[model samples]
Target chain A: MAYNDKVLEHYEKPRNVGSMDKNDLHVGTGMVGAPACGDVMKLQIRVNDAGVIDDAKFKTFGCGSAIASSSLVTEWIKGKTIDQALSIKNKDIAEELALPPVKIHCSVLAEDAIRSAVDDYRKKQKGGVNASGS
Target chain B: MNRVDVCWSCRGGVVAGEGFCPTCRVIQPPDPRRDHFHYFGLNPGFDLDLGVLDTVYRQRQQQFHPDLFVSRGATERRYSMEHVTRLNEGYRTLKDPLTRGEYLLKVTGFREQTPENATPSDPAFLLEIMEWRETLEEVDLKGKNAAMQLQQLRDRMMETCDAEVVTLGKGFHDWFVGGKREGLAVAAQHTDRLRYFTRFLDELDRKSELFF
Candidate 1:
């Protein structure tokens, strides 16, 4: 299937493609996978004291749509508040990337990753001692 | 794909797997309702005897061979083709452990549990999958020991995949034979793992081609 130019762009030169110290309290890691297609994505965000996402990173192993979805989210989430990031829907991502109907799930996976990362961050904030990597 | 009980030619009541209409002697269309197991006259369960499946497949293939229906009416010929097609599909699905497990899940109404984005609920499992992918990323394909490194990784992934298959079989057995509903969930998880492992293996194979 032919990918849109935007998807190909993010896929070929994914931005902020890396990892953060999961042990860091400021870092929230979101790991998600697609069982039907065997695609895995790890999206992370570093939130500042004011609850603003200052940095985001991701590593995805799958098709171009999946890679592009995660890559696009990392770029979009930076500087946004956690609440703003939470409001980011998969449909928006799919539209931004011009994802096909079949690949909409890739965007959903990205959305799930971001939500999980935010949830992890919130859990850490609520339970400082009992957070992950403790 | 409905279960056709009456012969299209003579409209005679046809029993399941009766092959020819009792009155018209025309080949009946395969019952769409009959699942892969039922297609082979086997009980709907996880554990299956390959030898029995093979024998039954061959026997049915001969009994419903499309060539035998060439002189029959258009409906009979179409029915022969449909029967052969379903038979081939059933055989393929039942012959493999993974596909068979998947088919059983579909037949048993657990299909929704493994949708397109049905990732495992456990973070640790995703973490392990991420580590495996990261390992593949870390390996320098152009390095002198790249082939060996890739080989080792492939072997380890294969072993893990095999273990997952074993777990899947046990899970299916518990659900289909031992009457445990929770076994379906376990089987679903392993099925997801198998799907991931299969794709991972395919990726590894593609990368290994770089060595050539």
Candidate 2:
């Protein structure tokens, strides 16, 4: 399928395609998958002491739409607070990317990844122990 | 597609599935709505017996072989061809554990290609996958005893896959018998993990072929 200009650009130059130290108490990691398509994604975020997300990164092994969706979300969440980042929705991502109807799931996957990473972060805070990394 | 209840050839009561018409010996067209298990009259759980599946497959093949229709009408020939294609496809899918599990999910409310934002909610499983990838990357396949090393790792992976298959089988049993949604979810997670392992195994095989 021919992706729109925005999706194409993001796919071509996907931003923050890497991993943060999962063991860091300030870092939260999320791993998600679409079993239907065998697509797996890992998204991570580093939060500051003030509860603001200082940075975000991702590594996704999936189709172009999936890659672009995760890339866009990482960029969007970088400067936002945890609560603000959780407010981000899949619809906005799909609209910005102009994703096809079938690939709307890619946007949903990105949104879930963000929530999961933040959830990991919160869990670690409550438990007072690092569980993401060895 | 609608389910056929009568034999097209003899106006006899046909089996409620896409299997061949028993009365007139006519090969029926494949029913898209019927799952592989229903097509073969097998249970929908994961604890399948290949011996039984093979027996049924061979019986179907013998009854509907395309050669049996060479002297028949064009319609008969077409039905024969469809029968052969679908029967073989169903057998191949049901014979493999990973494919069978995925097929079960597809037939039971899950879309075969529906991309969902929900990931398998198991952190330990995620960690295991990451470690596997790391170990695979760390292997030096060009060094001495590389072949043996690779063989050892392949064996280990297969062992894990087999264990996961058994786990998924019990999960399927629980879902069907106890009607637990949690059981289905566990089976789904195991199925997802199995898919990843299958892909990794295929990649490793390709790499080994190159090495040799």
Q: Top model by lDDT, which number?
A: 1
Worst 10 residues of 1 chain A by lDDT: A125-134
lDDT of 2 by residue, B11-109 (tens): 887755555677887766676667788778788878888898999999989988888889998888998888788889999899999988888777776
Pick out the ten consecutive residues of candidate 2 chain B with the lowest summed lDDT.
B110-119
Give the CAPRI class of candidate 2: acceptable
What would the TM-score be for candidate 1 when compared with the true structure? 0.90
Cα lDDT tens digits for candidate 2, A48-124: 99999999999876678998999999999989999999999999999999998999988998998998899888988
Q: Candidate 2, which segments miss by more than 4 Å at Cα?
A: A1-14, A126-134, B1-7, B10-35, B41-44, B105-115, B137-152, B174-185, B202-209
Per-residue lDDT value at B28 in model 1: 70
Instruction: List DockQ, one per candidate, in order.
Output: 0.75, 0.36
Give the per-residue lDDT digits (tens) of candidate 1, residues B1-212: 33447776777788865678889787776766677787788888767889999999899889878898888789888888888888899999988777787888899998844588854488898999899989998999989999999999999998998899889888988987789999998998888888888888889999999888
Among the numbered candidates, top TM-score falls to 1
**How well does candidate 1 match the true structure, expressed as C-alpha RMSD?**
2.9
**After best superposition, candidate 2 residue B87: deviation in angstroms?**
0.3
